[model samples]
Target chain A: MRVELDEPKCVAAGQCVMASPEVFDQREEDGVAILLEERPGDELLDGVREAVAVCPAAALRLVEE
Target chain B: MVVGASAAGLAATETLRREGYGGALTLIGEEPHAPYDRPPLSKQILSGEWSTDRLPLRRSTDLDGLDLDLRLGVAATGLELADRTVVLADGTRVPYDGLIVATGVRPRRLPGDGAHVLRTVDDALALRDRLAPGRRLVVVGAGFLGAEAAAVARGLGCAVTLLEPAPVPLAHAVGEQVGRVLSQAHLDHGVELRTGVTVTAVTEGGVRLADGELVEGDAVLVAVGSLPNTEWLVDCGLAVGDGLICDEYGEAAWGSPRPKAGGVYAAGDVARWYNALFGVPMRIEHRTNAAEQGMAVARNLLRPEARKPFTPVPYFWSDQYDMRVQAYGYLRGHDEVAVVDGDLSGRRFVAAYRTGDRLTGVLAVGMPPKAIRPWRQAIAARAAWHETVPTATPAAGARLDGR
Candidate 1:
């Protein structure tokens, strides 16, 4: 599974960083999300999904093939 | 799913898309323009440093590339949870797999005509246009918004009079000692600060205080407060006191999450959720809480597995008269106060709150690091009063010089 982000909508509220720091990180300047990886293994899937759910700007998306 | 394209809605949408759900995504916003930073409206936008074009949460070009059907300039008039559809003001019905209410809050309007309230970009612009040299502006309320408005108006070369009913401006929120300091900031800047004055009635060019003193002005901008935009859900059957009732995860007390109707979520200024620290339901209208809770709702929506509670240390800031006033944690229960650094008389200081040995919260004027460091300690060690001593090594932004 891959995570796709809508950068425009993201406000970098730090919810994703708090939930799963490995998958989601926040830019220092304006607090917008900086997605580390597009896709992750099953171990990180749950976290990536949680990150998506908590993003206030609705900026995260999960890509599946 | 249909979610309002706001701080909370945008966060929820992104979370849904990131969780490997490729279902059809529909985002709608009432404003024709995209979402933008709001806190700056009272500062940068009013000061002419930032323009409306630069205010959107995301640039229009970026929102368009998301491939989701983005609707702007359309208001969501009604919601049929049972039908799993929302009726737009344009007479269009959009079906949603899930619904997230992120309508946010609007400014409270004044009583009579010609009185203005600030909420949206348009509102700020209208006020800015009227704020010219030699014009008189009477702000009714000495809260953060009122203080910022007065400061901005003064900066714009307008005469401003700030009237607050409270003897101390922010005593309810920041304690009496700190509030006196805050009020003095306005007095130092030539703001005609009047405390304990209630505006009984507003006339054409002024407001009449309870003492029969008529305070005159060219225009009246009422910064009383804000009411959440939750009228649409009147029939939705939820416990909405000040705002829509929700759990910590941002799920509505009664609603369906799926398109069919199970788990509905609310965020931003609209959701009054259960708070862990206070042990009672609380509502946070700050920009930080909105974004954080929006994410929490999104995570809980997609996967129930490994869902974490949204227990955030509250933080808020205000920029007034070239000062960056920041605060962290709750100041509600603080009984004892200490001045860790700076002095109120100088109009630059940091006030720390404590309940016994526990540090409850911190407030600072332009001292970001000193204000923020205690929050980390408070959250990490849950530091109480006596335990929270001034460290030898201050954080990056701490002002080291002392009295």
Candidate 2:
């Protein structure tokens, strides 16, 4: 799975980090999402997809390979 | 099958597809339009910053590709658990292999037609049309929706007055100290903040207060919270108190035997489930919880054997003018609040809620989101109040005197 994050559109709701802590983290200064793992294995796909879906700002997107 | 095609229903449908549930799936919604994001209805939509076209929760193409039976403008009148059928308003019964109830809540409306309640897109559009320049907009309740509506009306060049019976505007939800700060923030933004007052009646052109005082306004907005949409499930035999009671795994905890293998589940604001983390049962009305709970219920429906409890750390955020208020965790029985960072006087700080020693909840006003993240973790871990070191100088703690 490939993850794409648009940091400029993030409202720092923290849904992404809550859904997928291993794949996403928030910047210390502004709380914007920071990508930790761009390509995660199958085990983490569900979490990553949830993070993308639950993002209030629609900042995160996933492209399945 | 999923009912109430809004945030929770749409999320559940999407999750079922993602989880490889290729069997027959159906989504039922009373509204004619597809599921749409509701948070912006009071903020951007009312302020005219965002168009109505941008309100949909999912793109049209994505929804079209879901390959599920979409039943719009059809209301579920009753549920027959004996036959696993949902009776519609038109007397047609739809059968399902498994059922997921995500029917959200409806806005509590006032008695008369003088006030408007916003719960749907139509309500927002009607309220938006009345927010003309130089008009008076009196909001009945000072909750999140009321405050946001007042802020939006003020931005639209309307005179906004927020009425609340409590000492402070969000006192019941965020405690008095933080509520006072937020009340001041609204006052700073030129909102006519009225506290310790009650509205007796809504007149044609204004509202009558308890003290025989008449506050004349062009429009009145009734923002007094919401009630769960559980009236249709009266015969479903589910434990419907304030909401549909469910187990931690979102299964209906009803009947004498509490059927474990049945395909009935509940989620979102309409479903009150036991929260293991807080050791209490709660029905969260926030959008984040709705989406998360919907997904959790969908997973449990697909894999009943390995069902996992939906114990999410409840989080909610509200935007009023330039101030953004965010909170996480359960703050119902908190006894004390400590300002760990920033100054309350500046209207930018992070406050932690504690019940004796365990940190129960956290609230941040105008603070960055990153600062609130660790507090969420701390609350989930049940960290001690003293363990959270104050990062700001001159730490100020406020004791919640009553409640």
Candidate 3:
């Protein structure tokens, strides 16, 4: 599993981190999404997909192989 | 119970009542008065022709018949999602079966003592007092709000100067054709229109430009932009972004490791979600978008099982210097544009925007009745570009009915 993010479209909503905490987090100042650990195990794949679906700006994307 | 009795909140409450929700409604707001018209703040309110007293969303008699427990001058401090209650500034917590978060945005403040922003009624009145005759008014940013302010200040006999960092004013939003009209308006009105300029220094009397040019003004109004008021919701642990995260149906799309709580929803400028037509999740802050979305959220909250998707064509308008500018649909990805009626040089015309072969948006200046409904229908039908051109007539304005 791999994760990609678009910083320009990010509004610091922090939804990506809330959906998959193991893979995403937020910066202190604005709460913009920060990738914590990418290429996560299969157990966290569903959560990653949820992160992509909920991002208001479509700022987060998940690449699963 | 509903806190923040703003446009979205009021619309939600009205919609809920219309849909036969009999639950007791408690509406609270920080303002002493009810929610009122905001757009007028830059126009009539700043011109001193309108007063803040006339801006409430509801009348005492109208609200009296609703059987509502309305609290004014109280602010929502925190949300205890577990308890399903919102904590107010006065240590009062109102619990509700469902919650609607519609605390709208405030103007993004700058780090200065004299600079002002135009978002609320108070802001408009303060700016009005500063716009005395012979005063020099410098406006930063050439967006709709800033442009409108420049026009009003000039109308009040003040010397106005507009500064836009972009190559052309409003080119990013409405394309360069409309932006040229803005530049032309300033030129015609004796306004010193400064494009591709930035304000690097500020003082009590004037602002210094990035190029070392001094724009002397008695008052400077910063109409840069706005940010959502979603600080309290960060702790609620829902999917948060530039706004409170909501799904297509305005439902909170929670993340993993965070517990998903039902009945949590967001609306107005603070709510961001995916627009089916735009193909991207965006945060729209226009008045119409908020009002329509508020109604959609209310209906969905009541009957989630059979709720329809929210897809009203995004539209917004501005009143500036005798021009009633109205735009329909989003123009984010538009690549082709054609002027259907009037001349661009006349500072009065309508321009249609298209992405590939699909008609995506239409913008009109000094012309409202011609563009609104057809643009609305085109957006609803996902009409193609070839299907939206104006019918050719003689030099005297063609009939655009078919288009």
Top DockQ model: 2
Model 1 alpha-carbon miss at residue B111, Å: 1.5
RMSD of each: 6.3, 2.5, 16.7
- TM-score of decoy 1: 0.81
DockQ comparisons of all candidates to the true complex: 0.13, 0.51, 0.01
Worst 10 residues of 2 chain A by lDDT: A56-65
Give per-residue CA lDDT, model 3, range A1-65, as digits (tens).
68778774454444466568788877654445788776778899867765664454445656555
| Pairs in clash, predicted candidate 3 | A11-B242, A13-B240, A13-B241, A14-B240, A18-B255, A19-B255, A19-B256, B35-B57
Tens digit of lDDT per residue, candidate 3, span B1-403?
Answer: 6666777777777777767898888877877767676767887789877666656555566567567788889888888777888888899878888888888787775556689889878788889999978999999888999999999999999999998898888887877766777678877987889888888766678887878787888999988889888776767667777888788887767755567457776778888877777566767887666766777888888897887667656767777887767777877667866777666667567777777777878777765352345565686688877767743521234222211
lDDT by residue (B1-403, candidate 2, tens digit) is: 9998998999899999988999888999999999987888888888878788877877787788789799999999898887888999889899988999988999887666768888888889999999988999999999999999998998889999899988788777778888888888789889999999988888888888889898889999999889999999875677788888898898877855443347888888899999988778999998888888899999999998889999888988888888888888887777877777787888788887877777888888888776777889998887877777443423554444424
Arrange candidates by lDDT, highest first: which order? 2, 3, 1
For candidate 2, the lDDT comes to 0.85
In Å, residue B183's CA in model 2 sits off its true spot by 0.5
TM-score, B chain alone, candidates in order: 0.90, 0.95, 0.92
Task: Score candidate 2 by DockQ.
Answer: 0.51
Residue B273 of candidate 1: its Cα lDDT? 83
**If scored against the real structure, what TM-score would every candidate get?**
0.81, 0.93, 0.80
How well is each residue in B60-105 modelled by candidate 1, as lDDT tens digits?
5656655578898998887777877788888998987667788888
lDDT of 1: 0.73
**B139 Cα displacement, candidate 2 (Å):** 0.4
